[model samples]
Target chain A: MEITINQTPFKLPQGASIAEAIEIFGAEPPYAIALNLTFVHRQRYGETFLTQGDALEIVQPVAGG
Target chain B: MSLPENPDPLVLYGTSFPSRLLLGTAQYPSPEVLRQAVEVSGPSFLTVSLRRQAAGHNETGGQAFWDLLSTLKIPFLPNTAGCHTPEEVWTTAQMAREVFETPWIKLELIGDDYTLQPDTLEMVGVAERLLKDGFKVLPYCTEDLVLCRRLVDIGCEAIMPWAAPIGTGRGALNPYALRLLRERLTVPMLIDAGIGRPSHACEVMEWGFDGVLLNTAVAKAADPIRLAGAFKKAIEAGREAFLGGAMTQRETAAASTPILGTPFWHQNPS
Candidate 1:
């Protein structure tokens, strides 16, 4: 399955949960994940299944001063 | 009739400030602490910078600090701190406008790496562009009266002259130049950087500066929350002193004692 993250598309293995994809991509942890415009909490990543062409946005906190 | 103690609300760019102090949201041990410090500071306005964050890195449980600021409902001043060119500042200002939905931008264009001083030429160019585009520009530059005049001529809403280099905490290094700038510029002027202590902030306010914008002085303090409150009080005190008008120093000495002297202490007790 192919999913877009931060405007970039990436392919993932079959039957991959959001957690597995995150681990595979080595995405920075402790982030906010949104799949198809809906936020998925980190605790729920285990059950949240991914589908083809899913739009996922991972946002991190930046220093603001 | 009984009179209230403090009057004259600090006004900036048509906004009435209940507290003269402005705080920055950075360099705390944690965001929770930063939020608490901000509350303690009691600032009517806070400064935030725009930058790129790597994907999937969150220490505060996926909560962006700006989101927290939005929840707090305080007015945010978006700054273009790291921008070195006119294009970068303009683009950052546009993005800030789109994201924050506010037209106010803190224009900062750094010229040299050592001092981190603003490039006046680039700042003027960007200020003109932003003004034409209908954005309220708050330019942060050195204590150059001519540069401030140019900014005003180019239609900036306010001019922020640096007291010293950004984040050095050296305090006001050029009070004479800053005072000259204050004397010359008709628009609102804020002493923007190198304010290390509450007394330093107070000194600038007492010198008739309209306001002060600082970050490291509070953020890097041993106790940021306490320092924030101190800054708040100091700013208010300084403004009050300025309004009340201080006593002028005399060049010639005036004897505290009466000029008529005693009979030489009764002729030295002869």
Candidate 2:
């Protein structure tokens, strides 16, 4: 199945979890994940499975005013 | 009534901070300069935002910046700078809380792209929801009295009103409205955005604002580190001046030297 990470398209194996997506995305530490505009807790990454075309945001600290 | 014995520390939502200046971690010349600026200023809080970890961009995607911020040990005040709606603010704030592990949020909802003004109409509702979610929300709003009153009514502990448009460095554009907001609302008010110089920060601080938050003023300076120190001093000076009480203004000029002691002093007949 293909899912989007940070709005970028990527192909993952069927039933791939958010944790797997994070690993695939190679996101750095001190980041947070939001699945379809909902916050996915860190511990729920493994149990939460991603379906086709699901949007996930891997966000990290950036400079802001 | 006499002022509190110890009012030096600026208080917001039951938390006390020694410094009244909050710095933004953006637009610094370099990471090293930012670090030094943080050290010199000793800001009460440092503002940060969250962004996507784009492909092949991890090198500058904030891990190193995070590492640097961690060592500095300043409390983080994550902002939802670009969100335009309640849902966007809600999601962005949740992500910020998860990443920064702090309940404090600088809620920013941009209504206009050109001026980057806060959508005063929608912000009250957004702030209410965030407050219900157990977050300490500091709303970035205009100098409008009614809007700020509504925000306070919705349980915002502190309010941040723009001194001018974001990044323009124009300073407080509406003194009358800002002063009215200051007088009407008892909550802590911080002048955020549109601050170009230390004097700009000082001017608002002298108006009894609780603090000042800025990114461009110090970050864009030719000497950001030195400018940070200057801001720190200016903030303190302004606060002190406000507390010490300034003389009243009058149309007639008052002589400092006593007329009796002046050698060439003469009274003019009306």
Candidate 3:
């Protein structure tokens, strides 16, 4: 199945967990992810499952004013 | 003669800040420069944001930036930089709270791309949602009176109105409106963005604004560190001036010397 992470396409196994998607997406520690425009807590990453074309956003800290 | 330091500390969401200047962790040439600028400015609070991680790229400078921010020890404010809608802002704010573990958020809801102006209509709604979720919201808005009043009405304890558009560096675009806000709103008001120089920050402080937040002026300067120190001192000076009670301006000239101590060149000679 194909899932979109940060607008990038990635092929992952069906019923892939959010944690596994993070691993395949190369998101490092100290980052946050949103599945389908809603926040996914770190503790629930294991339970959150992703399907094809799921929009997952992995974001990190950056400069702001 | 220098006066005694002002004892008033800026209290936002129950936290007290000794320094009234808030630095932005953006536009610096490097992470080291941003760190040094924060060091000299002595700002108690700073602003940061969250960005989507680039594809197949983890070295997008997030870790190093976080590392530097950690060492600086300044409380970083997470903002919804490009979020156009309340839902976008809400989602981003939630993620930021988890990532930084801070309930404080600088909510930036842009309505127009050209001006990057904040969405006044939706600002209150966004703030209300965040406040309900126990997040301390400091909304970045224009120098509009009724909008600010509504934000206050919606239970925002602190509000940040732009001095000008973000990154314009024009400084205090509307003094009258800003003054009115300072007069009407009892809650903490921070002049954020469009500060071009130290004097700009000082002027806002002198006007009794609780604090000033800036990024481009200091970060884009030739000597960011020195400018940061200058801003720090200016804000302090302005705060002192406000506490000292500025004298009202006069239309006619007035003599500082008493007539009893007049010299030979006094009115008698004339």
Q: What lDDT does candidate 2 reach at residue B50?
A: 93
Best by DockQ: 2
Lowest lDDT 10-residue stretch of candidate 2 chain B:
B54-63
lDDT per residue for candidate 2 within B142-208, as digits (tens), equals: 9988999999988998999999999999888998888888889899999999999999998898888
Q: Predict model 3's lDDT versus the native.
A: 0.89
lDDT of 2: 0.90
What CAPRI grade goes to candidate 1?
Answer: incorrect
lDDT of 1 by residue, B1-270 (tens): 975643676666676667676677767777777787778877766777654334454553234665677676777777877888887677667656654567778888999989999997778988998889888788888888888888888787688888889888988998889877777877777788889999999998998887788789988988888888888889888888888887788999998888687557556755
**Could you give the CAPRI-style class of model 3?**
high
Clashes of 1: 0
lDDT scores of the candidates, listed in order:
0.76, 0.90, 0.89
Q: Sorted by DockQ, highest first, which candidate order results?
A: 2, 3, 1
Q: What's the lDDT for residue A13 in model 1?
A: 84
The clash numbers for all candidates, in the given order, read 0, 0, 0
B68-157 per-residue lDDT for model 3 (tens digits): 778998887888999998999999999999989999999999999999999999999989999999999999999899999999999899
Candidate 1 chain B lDDT trough over 10 residues, lowest sum = B53-62
Clashing pairs in 3: none
